[model samples]
Target: MKTTAKILNGLLILFLLVSCEKDELESTDPNLLNSANSEASENFNNGMIKSYSSDVVIQWNELLSQSIDNRLPQPAEVKIYVMVTLAMHDALNNVVPKYETYALDNSEVDASDITKKNIHTIADAAVSKAARDMMAQVFPPSTATADALLNSILSNIEDSDLKTRGIAIGQEATAAILQKRSGDFPLAFAGYPLYTEPGEYRSDFMPWAMANPPVWPANAVYAPNLGSLTPFGIESGDQFRDQAPFPLNSADYIKDYNEVKMLGCTSCPARTEEQTEIGAFYIENTSSFNNRVARALIVQKKLDGWEAARLIGLIEMSQMDSYIASFDGKYHFNLWRPITAVRLGDSDGIDETTGDASWTPTFTTPPTPEYPSTHSYNGGAAAAVFRAYFNTDHCDLDLISPYNLPGTTRHLSSFSQMARDNALSRIYIGYHFRNAIVVGERQGGELGKYVFENNLREIKKLK
Candidate 1:
């Protein structure tokens, strides 16, 4: 009886071991389990989907930079960036339903035909096509380059149904965004009338000693119609318009006037060497510099295609809206720049301030109305997006300004630090007053937060 019992017990133990192994095998088997039902299957699905590199985004952004380099106005540059990135993001999500589409509905992307085996290839094709189409449309001069990039990307994928479907999806997304943004571009400038009142904006025709003539003719106002362009993510351009600037004779105005007069002159003895460097370092194109920083972070974080598209889209959209908001306030308030304010100080009915007609700024001022600094607004918006995307303020960034302090690298420890430096730089360069910098940065921060919290949110899966 004892021998029989031992035999049965050994058989039961063997049966239990075989059953456990079968369970483990079944749990990992993709054919037998759904990705949502099994952790192993979920990981396997993710691995397959995220296997591809997001260099497509980087490549397209580079193409955008090349196409827009000194060729288009700032508002037009912002608009082009927004359109390209939005197309990329929307196309990728259509292929893989990872994020909410900005321009298309769920019915627009027929993901029912997509499978895990071809998801990444299809996604890559879609993104490449969308970027190519948008770039070609916005910048016809770069069509050949954009075409080459798309062909190079598609070469990796075999000519199959997946590729064709991806192209269709991409074309659809591009069309949707283009249709959505139709009539949003700035109108032709009709010439702004010069206002002679103190504290009002008027074009300064003062010529300066420089190697090259300015991009715009002397006394020409830059992008006066920019304020009328429609925003991407914000409700309206003037939704966050700042309050009126300080009165010309107020104590606040007097203090800021004196501060810029001392620290912001072309050869101010009060300005420190480091402050001069800071002033010069941030003089590059705002869109270009911010995108460069963003691309670096994308590489450093090793983000996949979806993550990179989403991040770039958010950053660009935030910047576009911020520019719109800033410009709206700019044209609405029509405040005079520091150069005009300082030169006409004595005539402004102010007792304490003195006018110096011979005064010059460290850098030539932008030709827009200057109550709030648009550059500072861009800095604040970009920094907010960076911090929100990383969920932290701290990031190691090494930046160089080829436009100003060429070959000199500046290292920043956090996004907020960068924003602060950028805002203060406007003051040092004598382009903006402290109040303008402060208000612009604050408005940008608010807009950035609103956009990140609201747009392109992740599509949460049902349990």
Candidate 2:
């Protein structure tokens, strides 16, 4: 009886996929798999592929930005982005075999039955379904929006059989990734221990927290358990952890201390106007900014669907692992932010340093351990992936700051230059010492290179 029921259920699903009209299936259940509106034409080309993939990625990224703006944990944001991209890549790959998949196995998605003529149309449907399902699963609040987006895309695909098969493949990819990442939620924040010793991290009073009591709680450390979360591509979170931050009373510490103290202050005379602008420009949410840059490059470079999927998958996965590695080192070292260090400089018994209780940073310091700057780390990882993917660091790219100075734009000539600017921004903003930025960028670069070389390689076709 159980075997008969299972077979009947399978037949019912097949019937829905093959026989039911698109509107009928959608009306039968609003929860059914749907499509997003893509600007892709039937003619396959780099530009068309960009239209197909970029629309899905960019929309989801907007959702991610909204979540971040609403104060979702950083780790959770990265995890969701990684999952969605991976699902999209795997689903597309399943339809049109190109690169090896990140999560889905060969047996799970057979593409031998798909003909070359129908590949692009079918792949677009698969990618849309995969992205929608993964986003809805990982970030539940975006379900309605995701569904609407999917419906818009699916409504445009006229072929019912192709769309149905694509949806099935996408659903299979989503199920694989969901199962792979089970139990991988960001751990609850149970509050970190307070330390009073010099060079140790301590939570500071946040005026913003007072302004919004519910979202920004007083003295809250941001995602202390982030390091413990599972990485998407890397072996483990600590695989690329940096060494401990500079010790107090050391020359390196003294040099970094004085640099930030003189320049990071809101009223510091040593800081130039350009430095201030640079600091403010890069202060937007890192993930959002990086994704925008990547998407622009994807369009500019004229990447096909396979290429775009691999590039984005690499960037997101590398950044995710970089965050994990940086967070691991952050909690392990438990170093104080520059604000804390400057306020209690003299207490560290370092004669070269002077305490300034009235010191204020140009920006509110992030509530996390300062060692191995996560922002710089993500920048380095992202730059590394870009450089590797393009086979060079040079590119004509322009980006606008999303926060601090919203309309300000910066043109960059190379990926490495952007990474360097990101590292320096941490110092100019007075959030991190120079040592942390340096080490963080280095660690991130290593992790990014590792992820690119190791994961999602192009499949070698036999003659």
Candidate 3:
């Protein structure tokens, strides 16, 4: 009897240990899955204005902006997108109309080894179903423009392609979008930035740049901070700029300022002396990234389509807010870019080491005042939000290019690493000082932390 009792106790202990290990390997680990469950009330704008296989998924989101510009209301944009994303992702997972992509509650813990080669194939069919259903909601031929546009937008799809199926589903989504809108054209375009033709620059841009010069600290030295109360406030721009590596009112700034104004418009291009290498990188690299996104959107399955659209929009919004904060901080500090300081090291009144001129950066320098990097802040902020979805220290995304650039590639280990790379690229390419990027990373992280801590909590409450 004593022997039997001991055996039973040992069996129970063994069972508990196995259960714990399984949970750890599966999802009991917060680091492996999403923990954000807070509800949100923000009328999901979908994007401030920003993929298929993750390429078709991209083009699909681009269409969102185009569709809205053509007359779709903000509410219509949100509804149509949400309906389609939800419907298609649902179909992909073999679920019904309302339960696609799993709710915040249903989000699963995907193991480290999860990779879907045929992910786009399944997403295509799901989106098609949603498109057809949504089109039924709109009242006119005009309402289904996205469907027509999509047909023309796609090229590589074969008869067996799921994307072709999504076009039909898109028709339904389009119609549904039209049904919900009241047809207020001007109001639809109300808050969008006023255009001054393709070539003309905004009148207010230069003024905004010139007037918002950064303010310097009283000492302008590298001593421990003077402990001013103003730093704690929300005011942006000047305070951050003063600490930047670039010197204000110097020739280096004039060169950068000129480039910012031209971005993609100037025939001269950034490669030439007139083009501050920054413009060259933007015109070159960013364009490639954008096109890649378009292709992904044009090809993804409906479920992935929804995920792609929602993610693209969400990231853009998050980035915009991040930029707003970083820019405000930069100008507030009255800092300079690294190039300016290193060039005139003696005048900087600091003991920091400066690098040689003629140093090329790994990435392009963006045209803006220095201190916190806009790219770093934006990149880091986007990464923070995405971390919840792909819970990994890094991603080895086999760097496939759908735009026919088969040879070009990169390996991203984590969202944070990607952000770090982006920030460092600026330095490698000689666009910013390392300090500016560090600050940008810090600020970007803080903004993202705020999203998870405050904004997401409010938004997820809705979830």
* Best TM-score among the predictions, by candidate number: 1
lDDT of 3: 0.41
lDDT per residue (tens digit) for residues 73-181 in model 1: 6767777888898999998888866678899664344555555677767887888899999999987888999999899889988999899988988998899999988
**Which regions of candidate 1 fall more than 4 Å away from where they truly are?**
1-47, 107-117, 187-189, 204-219, 461-463
TM-score of each: 0.86, 0.83, 0.42
Using lDDT as the yardstick, the better of models 1 and 2 is: 1
Tens digits of lDDT, candidate 3, 1-463: 9999999999999999999999877775563344431111112211110123344544444544444322432223333444444333333333112122322222342212212443344345445444445433432333476556445444334555445544444444444434433342211111112223311112222212222213222212111111121211123323333344444345554444333322222232443432333223222232123223323333432334435544443444345455456656643554444443334434434333332333223333333445566667656665665675344445444344333234545555666766676665554444555556677777766665555334312223444
> What ranges in model 3 sit over 4 Å off?
1-58, 62-303, 350-366, 400-407, 452-463
Worst 10 residues of 1 by lDDT: 205-214
Residue pairs with colliding backbones in model 1 are none
lDDT of each: 0.82, 0.78, 0.41
| CA shift of 183, model 2, Å | 1.7
